[model samples]
Target chain A: MKNLKLIIQREYLSRVKKKSFIITTLITPLAIGLFIFVLGFILSYSDSEKKTIAVVDHSGIFNKPADLAKSGNTSFELVDATVEELKANFEDTNFDAILYIPEIKNLYAQSHTIFFYSEKSPSLDLEMVLSNRVKNKIRNFKIKELNLNQKELDALNTSVDLDPEPISDTAKDKSKHTNAVAAGLGGFMGFIMYLTVFIYGMMVLRSVMEEKTNRIVEVMISSVKPFELMLGKIIGVGGVGLTQLAVWAILIPIIQIIASMFWGIDTSDINQLSMDQAGIDQEDVMGEFSMIMSEIANQNWWSIIPLFLFYFLGGYLLYASMFAAVGSAIGDDMTEGQALTIPITIPVAIAFYIMIVTVQSPNSNLAIFSSIFPLFSPIVMPARLAFEPPIWQMILSIVVLIGTCLFFTWVAGRIYRIGILMYGKKASFKELFRWFFKQY
Target chain B: MNSILSVQQVSKHYGDYTAVNNISFELKPGQLFGLLGPNGAGKTSLIRMMTTITSIDEGSIFFNQEKINSDTPGLIGYMPEERGLYKKMKVGDQLLYLAQLKGLSKKDAKAKIQSWLDRFEINDWWNKEINELSKGMQQKIQFISTVVHEPKLLILDEPFSGLDPINTNLIKSEIFRLKEAGTTIIFSTHRMEQVEEICEEIMLVNKGRAILKGNLQEIRNQYKKNLYEITLDQSPADLSNLPGNIQEQVDNQIIIHLEDDAMSNEILSFFTKQGIRIRSFKEILPSLNEIFIQSVEEVEA
Candidate 1:
């Protein structure tokens, strides 16, 4: 145990002191911040400028003047002119497009013809506002023609909107579905977990491959047992990975805060924040905004954090051991270890796919099953546990993951014991299974 | 009286292929024992078994009568045929890390590492990364890491292959220094001169078995062809009375080869009768390489 600690400490220090580690840890967060800022800026500017369409009202019924500003961020304009007059100078290009609705033969034609100077997909905001203004003008003309009272006119024009309420409330875990902030956060964390494991796991593999290629493992094995050397390397590289991660974890928030405070970011801008605009409120927007912010603040990171560390550390060790085993068995360089990478990587990649699809659907069966699988659990379970996961499932997943880690450690130990000594032969599945069965 | 390591009938196999057949030997304290063999002769397998690199297929290995496993390897130092120091790691840090692995405290590891670096005239190399060093220089760093704990048993395989003359001498002297300091060394090499120079005992393995194992001098003597070299007055021309094939005749020396390892009284008397004044007479000893080849060839025949 003491030796293992020594190994871990050495591994940690060697990497922590490296120039590359320091540079990468500090630069990545800055890049991410810049990406978010540039993307937000582009989106908001595009959404702010609503498309404008000029209407040529040929019929006397086109009397309602278009408003510059509507209820929300939408507007319309109307012109008193004939279709031919508007069409002659439509290329003047002040409006996004000029719409012509010729007097319909029956006034009840199922289709209306619209044309623009150039081909383009019509903007949805422009389409909605144009249809509403035309309908309003017709409705007012009809009211006057019938000489209906205001109450009857409202009754004739206004349509009832029915909102169906489900018999059951699915918002049982109010925190789970309100916004995908937790899920986004979970996905972000999952990306981090997966990336670091892959990078440093490959580092361990390379370290072994280099030593073997250099023929140094032959000597080191004499002083240290294959398992000790294998464990030492895994623990060492993991320590390096952990140190870099811990540094990033601590530093990124600091950097983000500095950047955010320097530049004012409007949280309520849907275009800026990439939020769904359908549920947006005109007056009570601040209420929804604060609810989200408060929910983010109230997250019980204390519980989720320890679980994150546990899974991250366990996942690193488990994967690194296999890397070392296959790395030594291959007896050459990085290219040879690639064959070993497929088996190691496929499960984690599958888990990443699951994390991306089901973070919002934590209750989905795919997420549930993946969260319990040891190989995938390192990424999935912690994400699910960020919100409230069932206590039984959490415990069960951890137990299963820990058991799997132990079993793999032993299996890696066997391969390492056999593989470290056998050289010039690529690690074959038949040999590996044979080695596993021929336990001494 | 205490042997530091004992290998008892250790055999190793790779599925159906036998890599090392049954072989056994004991190493005593303060003795430099040579393990001699050719490539693919299972010398490395035996060394790996002793070093806990591979488990014996049919036998046991002990350090001071205690079984050698991961925990007990601290008592042994191993310098493999190929040097294994981390090339990217700073020399001092690499030494300290390896030293600490052998259970040394940080302060002790540093101090010992510093002493070793200073002793090796490589104090300037402390901050130097290993990749910056020559292969011979890298070999020195590995050699230091191997015995940094001052282990009771040191196993070195081809410890001299890559060194230039000066570095080789420095290491050879240091190895003797280690043995004098009570470190039992199991030296493995194809270099016959090194074995003859340092080893008090040896075990020659070929085809996975110990063809010969015993005192280096005793083995040589026991397998001796009893050849003798005599340089007498050149004026005495009647030397044909001596019955043996003449192996060679250099200016003042005549090498009389023998058919068997027998006493030389007959030749001594014949030369004394010729009234030939003797210049010098000494037994022509068999070299370890010669004995190694002879032993393996005998096995084949």
Candidate 2:
């Protein structure tokens, strides 16, 4: 027990003290924030360049140039010129493009193809804005010709706001808004779990390979059991993973708070700036934002956080032990390591894909089975947790996951005991199986 | 006195291939015992079993008159032939970790590491990573890590392989000092001369079997052929009908091989009757290297 503790301490401290670990832990959140900021900035400014379009209309629907509306960066003006003349000399004039509206034989036609001639193609946003304006004008003309009541027509358009509530008396009350928030949270948690498993599990593998290739395993085995060494390493790397997660959780919010205090550059400020620049209604965005915040507040975090931690640890242990075994099996050949690692990574990658699907259909048969399956549950089950998966399913999944973790860890210990000391020869999957059954 | 370690017919096998075959040996307290064997002669296998890194297939091993088990590792120090230390770890931290793994408390490990670093006069190297140190410096650290816990039995395999002569002597003296402090030392190497100088009792293993075992001097005496070299004052006029067969003669000295029943006095009397002055006479015993090769070849044959 003391040896195990020492091994774990050495494994944990050695990695935690590395310059790379410190730099990465400190810099990643800032880099992500900077990236989001730059992206939003670029999106708001991408269409800032203004352009003028000259319209030669013969359809008489848009009778006056003053009735034509300007949207965003594109402005429209009526020109008293023929289509041929505008097309021939549109670039010579100040206008960026010439729009020709041909005479329509039927005002109530299902579709009308208009012509836009320019040296460069118009932006999709500009095209959509122009079409919507013309469609609205024609609709008004028809409405006036038909003598339709605008008030009655406006009142006739109805939208259904769905409130999904459980019919069962035992089921907890969950609003649709809360469900949306839960799905988003579940996705984020699942993604974090996936990243934790891959990053930290690979860390365990590299550490094991380092000890094996360095031939330190011989000395280490002489002092402690291989099982102790393996378990210590898995737990140690897992601790590093938890430490990194905790630091990020605390650091990102603190950094945001500091940035807002110093520069008034919080996320909401950026969102507001981008929304204003894009001509979106601030009230709608703020309303949605507050709704999301309230829904997040309404979540049962006391249960969710613990479940997230449980799945994260369970998934990490399951994969990290297998990774350690692969590391031990690998000799000096790097290609062999890659070959051995593929089996472990394939399931993780598949589980990530299944998680994406599970978020969309939380109660699907595929989601239920995968969430219950030990290999996929760590990722898929957490994604379904927010939807309040049946309590029995969660319990079964947790039990299976824990049992499988113990089983794999034992198997890995067996392989590792023989593999670490077995050098020169690259081990195959068959050989690992043999070692698993071989007595030491 | 009861032996500190006793291996009674211990064996190890890998599938159909036998690594160690019914090998038995004992080490007395404070004895510098040599485990001599050629490469692939099961020296490492036997050591692994002794250290409890691998289980014995047959027979039993006892340490301090108690049956060997998991706890026996804590009482044994092992430095494998393949020397290794964590390259990115500081020397002081690495030694402390290894010592702690061997059942030393953190405080004790720290104190012992500090004392060892001070004794080696490398106190400044406490914070330096193993990779930054020279090979000899790393070797010294490896040695310190092995002995920091102060086990009752110390097993060193090719301990001086990478050491410079100066560091080699330093480690050698420390090893001697440890043995003098009543630690039974197993010095395993194929280097015959060093074994001859350091080991009092030795076992020669070939093809996974002990072909020779006893005190070093006694073994040498047992393998000695009745051969003698005599330095004469002058060359003999005729060499016919000598008491012994002349193996080699150069100038005034002659080496003779005698029958098992022959006496040395006969040759001396024959020389005196020949009116030749005899300066000195001594028996010649075979070197350990010759005996090792001969025994191994015999086994192979």
Candidate 3:
């Protein structure tokens, strides 16, 4: 036990003290801040270039164009000219383009196509704006000619929002709005879990390979058991992973504050501007944002956080042991390392893909089975946690994951004990299997 | 004296191949022992079993008369043929880690590491990374790491392979110092001259079996043929009718192979009868190199 602790201390401190670790930990948040700043800068300047379009409505319905709905960066002006004359002398005019609306013989036609003539193609936004304004004017004229009450017709249109609520006693308190929030949060959690497993699992693999290639394993194993060395490394690297995550969790918000103070890029202001452009009410958006926030606040985080951590650690250990085995089996040949790593990575990749599907339909049979299966549960189960997967499924998943982790660690320990000593020969899957089963 | 370490019919097999077959030996405390073997001759396998890095397939190993187990590793210091330290780690930190792994407390490890560095006159190298040092310097550090914990038994495999003459002498003095302080040392190498100079007892292994072992001088004497070298004051005119077969004649010295019935006194008297003054006469024994090769070849044949 003391040897294990010493090994863990060496492994942890050696890595944590590296300059590369410190640099990466501090630079990642700054990089993210820089990216956001650039994005905001581009978005605020995207529509600064203005364009003018001359409207020649021969149908005379748009005689008063001042009342037409206007889009940002574009304005429409009524003109008294034929399409042919405008096309011939468009450069002579100050307008960027000419919108020609032909005279309509039947006002109740199903559809009408208008032409916008210019040397260059008109922007899609400008086209949509002009077409919508014309369409609304024609509709209003039709309503007036038919003697229809606009207020009553507007009232007749109805929208239905079907909010589902589970009748089960366990899920009696869950709301549809909460379910939406859960889906988003669950998918994010699953993605984070996937990244953690891949990144830290690979770290363990490379650390093992370093020891083997450096010829340090023999000296190390002489003092401590191979199993202790491996376990200590896994736990130690896991600690580093946790440290990095904690640092990021704290640094990202602090970086965002400093960035906002410097550039004055108020995200909420951007949201408000977009909302105003979309013709949405400020009160409606604020109400929706608060409801989502409240839904997040009302969640059972005590259970969810602990369960997430369990799955995160469980999945990391399971894959990390397999990676360590492959690292030991690989003797100088990196191509062989890749071949051995494929088997371990395939399951992780598959779990991530299934997580995407599981979040969409949390109650599907595939989701239920995969959530309970030990291999995929680390990712899939957490994805369904916010959706409140059945209590039994979560418990079974945790139990199976822990059991598999222990089994793999044992098996990997066997392979490592032999692999670290065997050199000059590339180990195939057959060789690893033989080592795994060989008596010690 | 009780044996510090004893191996009894220990064996290790890798699938169909036998690495160490029924090998047994014992080492007295404070003895500088040599474990000599050719490449792939099961020397490493035997050392690993003794160090508890691998299990004994068929027999048992006892350290200080207690059956070897996990705790035995703390009492043994092993430096493998292929040995290295973490290149990115500082000398002091790396040595401290290795010492702590051998069951030393942190404070003791730190103090021992500092004293070792001061002894080596490399106190400034405590903060230097292993990669920044030259190969000979790294070798010195590796040797220090092995002995810092001060184990009862030290096993060094090819410890002098990469060292320069100066560094080799430095490590050699340290090995002697440790042995003088009552540490049993097992020096494994195929280099015979060093063994002849340093080792008191020796074991020669070939093809996973011990072909020769015992006190170094006794083994040499046992393998010596009936050969003798004689040096006269001058070269004799009539060299014919000598009692033994002449092996080689160089100036005043003559090396002859004697038959079973012939004697060295008889050869001296013959030179005296020929009116030649005899200056020196001695029997010639084989060197450890010749004995090692001949034994291995005899086993092969």
Best by TM-score: 3
lDDT of 2 at B290: 93
Interface root-mean-square deviation, candidate 1:
2.4
Q: Which segments of model 3 are wrong by more than 4 Å?
A: A63-70, A83-92, A168-171, A257-261, A266-283, B230-235, B241-243, B250-253, B259-283, B297-301
lDDT of 1 by residue, B1-301 (tens): 9778888888898777787898888888898999988887888778877877677789898888788767776777888776667777999888887887787888988888889988988899998999899888988898889988888888898989878999999999999998899888989987777889889999888888889999998998987776789888774566576777778887657888877545466777777887777888889889888998898899989
lDDT by residue (A9-95, candidate 3, tens digit) is 878888888999999999999999998788778666545667788888877678554645467877778888887887788778888
On residues A186-266, what C-alpha lDDT tens digit does candidate 2 reach at each position?
788889888999999999999898888788889999999999999999999999999999999998887666655665456
Worst 10 residues of 2 chain B by lDDT: B258-267
Q: List, residue by residue over B1-301, the lDDT tens digit for candidate 3.
A: 8999999999999889998999999999999999998888899999999998988899999999999998999999999998999999989889989999999998999999899999999999988999999999999889988999999999999999999899989999999999999999999998888888899999999879999999999998788887899999998888898889999999999999887635777898899998999899988989998999998888888
Cα error of candidate 2 at position A113, Å:
4.0
User: Which regions in candidate 1 have their CA more than 4 angstroms from the true location?
Assistant: A45-193, A239-245, A250-254, A263-267, A270-285, A297-302, A356-361, A364-367, A386-389, B56-62, B65-71, B226-244, B247-255, B258-283
Give lDDT for model 1.
0.76
Chain A (candidate 1) TM-score to true chain A: 0.75
User: What is the C-alpha lDDT profile of model 2 across B1-301, one tens digit per residue?
Assistant: 9999999998899888898999999999999999998889899999999999888899999999999988999999999997699999988888888988888888988998999989999999988989999889888999998998999999999998988899989999999999999999999998888898899999999878999999999999888888999999999988896888999999999999988635788888888999999999989988899999888788778
Please name the candidate that would achieve the greatest DockQ relative to the true structure: 3
